[model samples]
Target: MPAKQRSFAQTLNAVAWSFIGLRRRRDFDEDVGALNPFYVIAGGVLGCALFIALLLGAVRLAVA
Candidate 1:
């Protein structure tokens, strides 16, 4: 029998989970619980900015 290969979406999900510390289950949960609302808001804003930048880059390439 052969092992199944991970899909691109699964790989990306793993990467994002690791980045947010979910790889360390207990610590990640505790850290998330301890996080302040302001920090959460800041992270949301940063994520939005990053997403917007990617979208803009794609649009520019399409226009070119």
Candidate 2:
């Protein structure tokens, strides 16, 4: 099977989905071949940062 072409948005979306723990086997398989490593790394880092920021904000809000 041919690899599916993925854009930067797609890579970012995939990384977000992964962080959210929602993924299908088919999509994972497609991403394996289509996603650029550099894009994935960048997306993952950005996603992690956003996630951390959100969590920190929530925690601060709860504590205050």
Candidate 3:
């Protein structure tokens, strides 16, 4: 059977779970088959950038 395509939101959810290291094996397997590579990479990069920005903002606030 062919893998089903996932929506952008679904891909983002998978990327978020990956970042937090909290995905279940079954869900991971499902996501692996459903997610798009482009969305995964874009979402991961965006998520990382957002995380870094939040950390920097927090540090700046603490120092000020």
Candidate 4:
């Protein structure tokens, strides 16, 4: 049997781009360049949230 495929979020991050009509490769590059700050802020926020959740879970497990 073939291995299972990964989830969409694991394989690609094009959901937002698709909604904005940036489906083409050139359009994607242009959009990315124009939205560099948004991307940076999003990445930072996601990273921090994930880190905090992991830390809290670890502490809870240890205390329990």
Candidate 5:
């Protein structure tokens, strides 16, 4: 069967779960076929940026 395409939000959700290393085995299996490469890469980069920004914000808050 052909893989089903995912929406942007679904892509980001998958990326977020991946970043934290918290996906269920079954879900990961399903996502393996469903996630778009372009969306995955974009979401990964965006997630990384947001994570860095949050860390910086927290550090600034602590310092201030």
Candidate 6:
């Protein structure tokens, strides 16, 4: 989400940054215009799934 459409990796990186709950205003502005909405949505879903899986795994270990 620079001056051009972001690639898959770039999209994921952006998604990751968002997940962390902090973003630079300059980057946010760039992403708002240049990042694909679909890719962002898909990346968010994938990230959430992975986070849930890791959380469940940790809980299982702790319980065991």
Question: Candidate 3 residues 1-64, lDDT tens each?
Answer: 8789999898999999889999999999877878999999999999999999999999999999
The lDDT per prediction is 0.58, 0.91, 0.93, 0.55, 0.93, 0.90
Which residue window of length 10 is worst by lDDT in model 1? 1-10
Pairs of colliding residues, candidate 5: none
Candidate 4 overall Cα lDDT vs. reference? 0.55
Give the lowest summed-lDDT range of ten residues in model 3: 26-35
**Which regions of candidate 6 are displaced past 4 Å?**
none
Superpose all Cα atoms of candidate 2 onto the true structure and report the RMSD in Å to 1 decimal: 1.4
Off by over 4 Å in 1: 1-28
Task: Please give the clash total of every predicted structure, in order.
Answer: 0, 0, 0, 0, 0, 0
Where is model 4 more than 4 Å wrong at Cα? 1-35
Tens digits of per-residue lDDT for model 1 on 1-64? Answer: 4334444444444445655656667644554445454545555566568778989999999999
Please report how far candidate 3 places residue 27 from its true position, in Å: 0.5
Task: Residues 1-64, candidate 6: write the lDDT tens digits.
Answer: 2478898789999999999978788899888878898999999999999999999999999999
Q: What digit string (tens of lDDT, one per residue) describes model 5 on residues 4-56?
A: 98999999998898899998899889989898999999999999999999999
lDDT of 2 by residue, 1-64 (tens): 7787789999999998988889888999878989999999999999989989999999999999
CA displacement after TM-score superposition, residue 46 of candidate 6 (Å)? 0.6
Evaluate model 5: give its TM-score. Answer: 0.91
Tell me, by TM-score, which candidate is best.
3
Poorest 10 consecutive residues of model 5 by lDDT? 23-32
- TM-scores across all candidates? 0.51, 0.86, 0.94, 0.46, 0.91, 0.90
Q: Candidate 1 — which pairs collide?
A: none
Better of 1 and 3 by TM-score: 3
Superposed Cα deviation of residue 22, candidate 2 (Å): 1.1
